[model samples]
Target: MTEAVQIRPEQFPLTRECPFSPPKEYRDLREEAPIARVNLLDGKWAWALTRHEDVRTMLSDPRFSADRSNPDFPQMVMGRVQDDDAEKSLISMDAPEHGPARRAVLGEFTVRRMEALRPRIQEIVDERIDAMLAGPRPVDLVRELSLPVPSLVICELLGVPYSDHEFFQAHTATMVSRQSSVPDRRAAFQAVQTYLGDLILLKEKDPSEDDLLGRQIIKGREEGTYRHRALVAMAFLLLLAGHETTANMISLSTVALLENPDQLALVKADPARTLPAVEELLRYFTIVDTVTARVATEDVPLGGVTIRAGEGVLGLGFAANRDPEAFADPDDLDIERGARHHVAFGFGPHQCLGQNLARMELQIVIDTLFRRIPDLALAEPVGKLAFKDEAAIYGMYSLPVTW
Candidate 1:
């Protein structure tokens, strides 16, 4: 195998100078050093994968473990948040444990289940749009529509009351931000964990058929898979990821489409085109690119290098999605390009379970927003907009827009 470049971990998870694309270093790494040792935010040295083929290979390969408790597992976030509990979140689990954990909630996110909720999702998106149209001009979509849509959906899904959205949303934001102090992130992380843990306890005692978590509680109990701590971890994952990632995608996608009128026209003119457009945008942003990290269980040869046992690896989703080898003119946003292999939702056993829900939400939001507000335009210049550049997930902090 070829030698991989060695660099300090602090030099990794490079900042995005352009809100629309991955960090400039991603290009350099993909072309010159597809697999390189780089220091992470926590100063841990790990091999970072930049190529589409290699990222897919590494993520799918069982040799690279996803157990975050493993000292060798990479810390991909701005601040490392640890739970003292022995139960690991599904995203951080490997093999036998991961499979059962994921399968427990898999039915909740299947295509049929997600599709059944489409009409409800449609109502939510349209209602948010209606509120936006009636409310004051120059609204922040992040607050008004983008954030609320997914936040509401997930709130109802997990049986959490929507009135307490601010509490969880605020804490969720703190946890993902690079700017958030370690103590602050810890506090936010704890606040949400405590809240969810309590909620899960209540749900377990009185299961309700009306919600996903409630239903899961009943289901898991029958299967002998419902451990309180483990359920808490799953609930936390679903609650946070359910809203945050999809919120960012909605805002960023609106910006991308607004900026590219020609491309926007394609989506607007054809209702059938919205699905591919949503997929393309998801691929284009690959917002959660930094988090798909793993550590080698044993030395595994991949992408012209051998990632040693106990070494960390990151599949640069943004870089992999934008890989020229994976698409023609990979950097350019082409909604027409049917790129099904995009790692936006990632690959392998650990792929995002809420992806079906997220996709439907995006499809409905994108299709409805533009159709309702034909004159939608940016109220502020793209360059002046503040982006969540320091966050583990890249997104616009606020998208100023008017119809």
Candidate 2:
């Protein structure tokens, strides 16, 4: 008889120092046991969903609640002051609450709306490319392009002054960096919250006809249902979630392309193929690994296993995208795999609200990069590229690039 396969605590900590790619153990575990108990830091246990189908089901299933208000819900980082309030955001709420809260901003992120922003997005991408070309050849893409393009775009969209980007970016960095101490992270959160709260008050005083926050404020005022705290929470959510995920994707996808010359050539030769390629790359490099955590509302059987009430489950986005059952060859980055069915943005009602904007940003960036710098390649050796292995969102600290 075979010994029951188990994921050792140290091997699979929430903060594993490894490449952005999914761990090989995930594939092994998915084949042997899709749903297995994993020991976390402090000897806590959480269910890890690895299979593609299982992950999809778990994400959409109502029984798997993201109610962060629950006592047993796993915290992103243990022992943080604003951890409770941070968890109460849309990502952590259950259906009835999560749905409407998400709907409030859905109109801004729809594919149609995102399409309308393409020209503006393209302009932003072009401006970044021009800046990169003007600067040092081996500049860090994270600082010049990956971080700024999305950062500025999100700022403009959310009605925040672009001049304040540096402060917000620093605050966001400290909050998301795993290396930061509890107090430091808490301080960062408080700073961002306070900053956004002030911004909300300003918007309330003199609202604009456009911009997401402005529109939200107007809607809330008209409906007479807007709570100041909710506005602050949504603003924080949009700023962090809107930019960070896409920024990581842009950097990671560019790295993946530079690594695979053939694929890069394919994309460079025919820019029309970028959208599908972006989809494939998004699947290939699922960076937000295990960031989405949900608690079991009640006893529910899943994937031939019973999950008890109050037990937490993590939807391993990285693992699920690489499930062999979901794709013909999960590891191979086939540009034409028609990977639209992939769960990179997740599934169900709580799917990423900014997915459209994300896709648009990726599309424009890829298109403009190839058009402007067809000879683009990584400046440093692939092995030498530094990854933020400890980040909640798997990413490269700096992607040095040259043409």
Candidate 3:
């Protein structure tokens, strides 16, 4: 039986009253109205799925389409940083197309492959920390460590020159930020797309099988599946997503552990717990919450509500991860929770492809930073610090630390 929903739609992209946790409204809605309606920034309405079970079920069901180009698909933010306007890649592709595209690239991120990159990742973390140590007492970890680690990794993986990171990262900032005008977003998207398109041509003239995009170009043409436009869009997705999401997680995870000293002590005392703690951090701070909004292809019954065909549903992953039914003491940040089942990476067909790599990067960064700088402490209170509150992604602008 479908439960009754509320008549008044809550505003989408709800603000966090506290930086450490999700909005309190989510907790109430999870219990009372798991499928509550939300008014988006574009003034469009979509049902926000708060319950963990419902979110997982909806994401997996074929009846709900993941295609961003679908006219009825929910646009949670009015002008999103990244564009899904081009040919379908893994992100916006559904079913048959999604399967092939995912398979083509999945090998690059396999556990064995990621494990091979462990030494390199550790080196990156150590170098960043070394620089931080040698420099002034107080440094912005966002610049010193958080952003650079993932940004450099993605650049290397995609064959992009790390020298041009400033240009792309600046544009990425404008793109993800909701404060940017639609025209600003379009320009930013074009800048990235144009840069990637040119890179695609360069790879065609002189390609290397070492990097991800180049490998795809070489392999796809041989298989007769190569499309220039599709490949360019794929690069854009990989380049932006590869860096942005993980960078935010790195910063947020550090702050989380610092705030909860007991959890930090547990992790520092035992080396084996780092990976599980990273999983719990992923669950605790599900940053890209509503970006997975989907439109129903057919009338579907969910959480005691009939979502009619053409209607949209916002998968509130942040809320679902904190659902009490799926997690014990949902609000508490328990690093020992062993929350491997959490939907921080989303679930089923659309789970994050780079998850294994992300896990490895976070583990190396967190473990090394603490071990090297045993006296590491925040230079400023979290309240006084600037946060990316207006951005599509949830993270801080800077983390000032002194050791």
> What's the lDDT of the predicted structure labeled candidate 3?
0.87
- Per-residue lDDT over 1-403 for candidate 3, one digit per residue giving the tens place of the 0 to 100 score: 4354443423457777688788888887787778877666676778889999999999999899998888788886675445555566568888877898889888998999999889988999999998999999789999989999999999999899999999999998889887789899889988988999998899988779989888988899899998888888778888888889999999999888899999999999997999999999999989888867899999998878899999999899999999888999977889899899999999989989899999999999989999999778989988888888778888888999997
> For residues 253-276, could you state the per-residue lDDT of candidate 1 as single tens digits?
999999999999999899898889
Model 2: weakest 10-residue lDDT segment is 1-10
Candidate 1 off by > 4 Å: 1-10, 77-79
RMSD of 1: 1.4
Report, for every candidate in turn, its global Cα lDDT versus the true structure: 0.87, 0.81, 0.87
Ranked by lDDT, the better of candidates 2 and 3 is 3
CA RMSD per model (angstroms): 1.4, 2.1, 1.7
lDDT: the better of candidates 1 and 2: 1
* Predicted structure 1, TM vs. truth: 0.97
Per-candidate TM-scores read 0.97, 0.95, 0.96
Q: In model 1, what lDDT does residue 60 have?
A: 93
